[model samples]
Target: MGQEFQGGVGQVAEGDINNYGININLPDKPEFRGLVTAQRKELHELRAKCEELGDDPRDVWRRVHAQLGVCSISEITAEQFHEARTVISGRLEQLQEEADKRRLMGKILRSTAEKDARQEMLNFCDLSFGRTQLSHLKRNELQRVLEFVQQVEINPQPAAEIPQVQTAEPLQLREFLLMYKTNAAGLFLFGIFVGRFWS
Candidate 1:
């Protein structure tokens, strides 16, 4: 008699099964199963990291394939999968470290500069972290901040040299009128000189 195939949801074999004409051979050894499971988990984690880093999943997978010297993920062996996992995990850790560094720089920027200045800095650096909200920046934005920080480190600027932001209230009516009159007088003299020249 032929080997009996169980008929239940959980009784399905470990590998892909197609009722048509395709056949996929799954490893029977427990260790091989474990390795495949680990490889899939690591691939999932790397995909998640790619999303967090705002990178294309296909591109990241291609890079992983290149790093492991494999043509495709499907062809990756247990050892190669382990190496890929290590490389991906290291990249994730590096992104986390960069995010931490960006947070520190944001704190410094907030402490030393005003909201407008911080916003300007973010704009110049092509970052998306808001002036009032710098708690959790995306990886790319954090990288932008990291680059800005490195530039600042290379050409150090004194803290005292940073421009101060004026958050004072609007001027009073009398103060506004006085200032307007002073500016008007200068403009009047300049206009007279120009008019005389034209005449």
Candidate 2:
């Protein structure tokens, strides 16, 4: 069975804490918990290795940073992604075979991780975070899918750059006087032409 707590996912039982003395910050965001938990477990395993290898604490952290720098696989077409998944599974299995007999735990983590990744991909494809996996996502949905794909990042506009007053320019005295004179001349000509008729 998968890890469970009385409160919910990521909630450590009081007993679990007493027995294991594990007090790491459990991510509260339910959606992100799986990925965060997997990363934490990997860190713990690496730390254990450092303890075994007599590596310096700073060196261990630096090594972890370097490993984290390894970029995620590029987002690919559905067909290409399926092919990559086949290759990735084969590679993971090979790696797992070399490690201790932790096959079952690895399977659980892998399954959880794949679920999360697929959900994320689906969100992008549907242009919706609230969408489910079984929902239709096809050629017509490409634009929606791209919204969450992170193919490129957008920089937000700075508030300081926004003009406080839209009419920022001062009215020129010369322009105002010219307009007034033009209006006055038109009124004067109108008075001369129409005043005689009224009289």
In candidate 2, what are the lDDT values of residues 77-105, reduced to their tens digit? 33333343344334344444434234333
lDDT of 1 at 93: 74
Q: Per-residue CA lDDT of candidate 1, range 5-61, in tens?
A: 544433356556545544556656554322487668768877798669655677767
Worst 10 residues of 1 by lDDT: 1-10
Local distance difference test, each candidate: 0.64, 0.45
- Screening candidate 1 with a backbone cut-off below 3 angstroms (N, C-alpha, C), the clashing residue pairs are none
